[model samples]
Target: MTSSLRYWKKNNLTYVLHIPPHPIPKSPQASPSKTHVPLRPVSPLQNRTDIVVDHTKWGKILGRIGSESIHIPKVLSKADVHTLTAYIAYLTSSGHPREVKELLWALFPELNTSKYPSNSEEHSHRALGRKGLLTTYRRAIFLGPVFLSAVLNALYKSNQPILADRIWTLAKKAERLSWARKLLPNVKPWIMGPHAYTVMINCYSSLARRQYWRMVLRPQRLNYRTAIASVWGTLRYKCQILPRPLPSHQVMELMHDLMRHAALVVFRRFMNLRHDYAEIPEMRRWLAEKDIPKPDARFFNAALRAFRPRTPPMRKSWYRRQLRDAKFNLDFKGVLPNSNDGWNGSLHEVAKNMIHAGFPLPPGLQPLFVGRLRGFDLPVVHGPDRGPFAYRPQKIHPWLRYRLHTPKEKGLPVSRAYPQFREVLAQRRRHRRSRKRQRNRRAEQDAQRVAPKVLSL
Candidate 1:
């Protein structure tokens, strides 16, 4: 027993052998055991790679994707409308009255306003008042049954003639004629000078309506005096009045009827006169009949000499010996003067005939005779080539080579003489300096690469 106990203690045999087994108990179903699965650790290098990809390339892709989703709305808010309205109002109130009216009309079409609305009596009075047409605000407002009393009160109270004139001028530019006419009467007294009356008549004349002219002439209706008075006034002021005066009513009517015929006759006479000067015999006869004074002897001789053809007179046998020692050709032959007699008559005679006939030389020839006489050289340039040195010299600087080749020749530096050359040298030096700096940088980089860094503990 003792040995068995010792053996049990030594080997734990009893606990191992103490299995209680009886009748082979049925085996229970085996249960599965739970097992723990360890998680894999993320690498620091992998996190760095992800950040680099996002920062370098993927970040751009994400940004573009986000930007594509953005949208902007398109509607003008109340502030925008107010701003536009203020700008338009400011532009309208500042001397651009016509444009202001136009813009207002465009904005409010229901105003039933025409730029010149003759049908509206209130508008007509306003237009007239603005143009300074009425003789007085009271006359415009009260005298005329079709006037706007309230508007006249406002315009008359303002009583600014200069401003009214400016507005009237603007109205004229806008073709508000009826309105412009309204201002005529009131401004007439202020504009009593010649310029004023002329402008008034011109305004009526430009209408091209005979009725308007008659209206202006009639003292009863338009209040302008007689046509003669109008002309006298114009002359007093040194102004040119049109519709030239006629000697009689009969002549005026006759001229009016024959205007076209008169023009045709005048044109035909002008053309015929232009052709008459070309015929030499006819020109001389006309000059002789006119009894014109002759030109001075010197002038006549100069002109005659110009017309005479050069006959190589120096080359004649007698002159040959005289000029033989000279270094010029003395050739002579059967050369004779040209027989043209066109310029023989005195210029004075020609001029008198031209004056009597109410014609002058064609404008082209007038300048020839009236201007410089440089072109009046003796028409016939004769004689041989005159001298050995007839032609001008060709070689300009023959001494330049000798000066350049001299032994003591000191050369000027190109940069000293030419500023452009100095600039070029400066640019070249800068380029060399840049290259040297780049080379130094590369050498430093190489040295750093070859050198070793000591590790700190």
Candidate 2:
């Protein structure tokens, strides 16, 4: 029982047995492990050392070359630097190469000095070439118009007139006329600002041409066809006379000449028309010996107003009467309108007389007369009851009247009705159908409830 109990205790209880004492262990001395052993030194390739030396020599040589190449000698003087800066500024502002040259010459008189001096012409040419060098300077510094003007002035003062003229022309053409004009008087004292003068003359000449064209062609209703044709004809004739490649200075002169020639042509055409009426003895006598009507104050005033150097009140009625009286042919119609005849009959008589007087309808303008005739037949509406016959000769159409008279609120309702009134009416009809169906269903239900039901056996 005791052995069994022990076995049970050993097996079942799993007893923790005690062991006898053992000696304490000492730590081992530190030594290099096989896993952590140091590796042997690697020998570099023999050719690699030579390569490294060659690289070192190459680096030194390249460094020396770079140092030598980058070093620049300061040969320019303090005065030279200032002169160059001023010259560049002048070229940029004035836009003239000649001015640049002159400025350079003024600043650096010794620039032209040589053991053997060149001829005056050669020297001048050389000076111009040097001025052109400023263009390079201009490109570098991005010098603008202010600097260009100063440069041009200098060139002009140096007696380089041709170069100055060329530069001035280019500058004027490149810059806006307004800017050039403002700069002109200031720069003119130093340089020849003739291009500014040319621009002004050309502008005035163009205005004159426009006025003359308007007077001759009489373009009604802002339709510029006649004016365009007249201007084109004038330009064609001017081109034939002067041709192209004309210098800037000569364009104004050419335009003036063309204008004078055009005026003479118009005068001659008027004279030829007057000569046609000389067949009649009285007309011939009048042509031979009649005092030309002297232009009155009104005529001079009209002419001056047409030119319009200043704003003035126009005498529109006087000009209109002049245009009417200028009609040469007249047709006399003697159809006495009866007192009972309407105003329409008088209008018809006047129109017939105009047609008989050889005043044929103008080509594109006939449609306007046709439109007016059609308009006369349209019924005019005054108010709701007093309409369809209350036609004022100049009254507008009924559609236009409705547009002018309709009140904002009464016009249309907000919602789908504003966009499409018909769609709103359709939608209202659909809603009514749905309501009708619902009412019929309710009536049937009420009938069922009221009627008696028989029970089946």
Backbone clashes, candidate 1: 5
- Model 2, span 91-113: residue lDDT tens: 55455544466554454343342
Candidate 1 stretches with Cα past 4 Å from truth are: 1-71, 78-85, 89-102, 108-457
Name the lDDT of candidate 2. 0.36
Q: Tell me the TM-score of each prediction against the true structure.
A: 0.14, 0.17
- Top-TM-score structure, candidate number: 2
Give the Cα lDDT of each candidate.
0.31, 0.36
* Candidate 1 structure quality by residue, lDDT tens digits, 1-457: 0111000123422211222223422556644343344333323342232222233465556534532465677885554334544554445335333444454334324323234332334976567444443223323222221112111122223433222323323222322222233434342211111222222222222222222111122122211222222322322222222343323443333323232232223223333433443343452233342333222222222222322223343323433332242212212433222224122233333333333433323221222232222222123222333324434433321222001111111333222447887888999999999999999999999878667552221
Candidate 1 scores a C-alpha RMSD against the true structure in Å of 36.2
List all candidate RMSDs to the true structure.
36.2, 31.2
